[model samples]
Target: MTGRTPAPSDRTSRRRRAGVVVPHQPTRLQRLLARLVFLLIRAVALTLRRSLVDRTGCHDPLPPRAIYAVWHNRLALCLEAYRTYARPRSAARGLAALVSASRDGGFLAAVLECYGVRPVRGSSSRRGPQALLELTTWAERGYDLAITPDGPRGPRYVVQDGVISLAQVTGLPIVPASYRLSRFLRLRSWDGFIVPLPFARWEVILGKPLHVPRQVSETEREEFRRELQRRLLEITQD
Candidate 1:
């Protein structure tokens, strides 16, 4: 028996499946709460005594563009770290970070906007393809990207394949960065979220960039993922 070619409708359906979906929009209440949270974050960030530990020159003076991989637990200081460290030295003018597409993510996206950071909403569970496409768009515009490999819910410090795929697709180096807080509270959350105490010493550590080849085998991608996980573990504090 001979095989039949797919119909035009079948091809159209496939194209639709590959297309990006619209991101979740924040509700009015979520927006309002986000503003309050942004104010609180701003107040807390200003009182911290911040420092940087960049042995790898990759972040001291950021490259034209790169992907930053930080642990999920250390996200509390991500914006502060960027504003204090990367933004000043980066040749890139904007930062676009991956975020979830849930209701909570809506609030977070708003807070990110408050910091002038663009949020690409999606995650492994929802709108994943759409988010990756959006991130690629931002990258083409010369914006630096950030992703918490184990974020939006996580297995703590474990790195996921999303970051690896992103690095491969964007052809950007993954710079592992983490934080050490002299004084802070650990929230009873999935990621043990950190809340820094007033006037505490906050350190941002950036590791060497791991470049992912544009063409890589599944085994190679896994290797890169493990390498990123190891580097993040090295820099992250419990």
Candidate 2:
């Protein structure tokens, strides 16, 4: 006896059984709180950066187009630095970041909006496909893409395939950047979430652009990934 093809509802049920479900929606109050937290963090970061790291990177304008890749843990300070430095200097070239699609990520999207950073919601584990499509579309429309290669919950600084894949698809150079702080607190989180105290000394490190060729092989991809990981580690090393 032969089995019949499954109905659309049956297929949907099977997918749910495989562990996919709609995400929870954040309440307005929750969003407000998240925005407040984001503003507070941005304020602290800007203040610390002003007193600490010299605005060298910001002094020169950013290329009209480029991909910005930074570590997940360093995101707190990075957001502020990019806006105060790169964005305005680039004459508002505009930046689109890959954020997670989880409910927790809703807050992050809101936060990025407050800073004039566009958020494309997705991650390796969720909404990744849709987000990637959106990112590519935005890139075509002239927005510089920003990605936290190891993010939305992490093994703490491990670079993921998404960054490389995006570079290959978009033919954009991955500009690796990170910052080190003299007096900062590291959260006991997966990414050791770095938060610099106000007026702390800091160094903003920008590495050369990394290019991923369109015809890269599996081995070559891994090599580039390792190289990116090494550069990021070097920048963040205390």
Candidate 3:
């Protein structure tokens, strides 16, 4: 007998089973906390409905895929901004983002799913190669890849090397982006996590795309990384 075609969900499940990367499998307390956090985020997001300022010259016909690089602190808002700005360009295109494979990351993956985004579990220190390959596969399938270049524990706002490698391997331009809020709270977390209050006006900035050539040397890659960091910081407002 012949087997039936697998659903997308099934494929994702298989990837996890095959050790590509796995989402959080929390304990009871953690599960409850994740749910509660998701609720709070949902309430705030719905009430606020933040706005974006498209400076990246990527409107009307959105590019097929540009690796979205954003600061870790701005992860919350940028996810929403990207879904709002890029998803409508064509229903066919989707987004697959990198999330850490940690306990906290498990909570974050749940949150992203709540917002209709696919979360790939991995980080610089865990399953990094698997995540890169999976993200590349997603990009090939027309899904815009989103990554926090400074994430999974950070030196605070410094871009990591993985993103540069990703751009070089995938031949996708690195699009540095961020959102500024008129009113917000800052956490003592390493990335200086910003939590925007409800009804605050948002100024979302999409900086120019930095393309990394396929034949880039190690020195050239670091140069591109610094350039990416500069461009990202340039669009960010204090």
Global lDDT scores for all candidate models: 0.85, 0.77, 0.81
Candidate 3 lDDT (Cα, 0 to 1): 0.81
Per-residue lDDT tens digits for candidate 3, residues 175-197, read 88888888889998888889978
- Sorted on TM-score, best first, the list reads 1, 3, 2
Ranking by lDDT: 1, 3, 2
Clashes of 2: 0
Highest lDDT scorer: 1
TM-score of 2: 0.83
Clashes of each: 0, 0, 0
What's the true lDDT of residue 51 in model 1? 87
Worst 10 residues of 3 by lDDT: 19-28
Reference-based lDDT, residue 158, model 1? 83
Of the candidates shown, which would achieve the greatest TM-score relative to the real structure? 1
Clashing pairs in 2: none
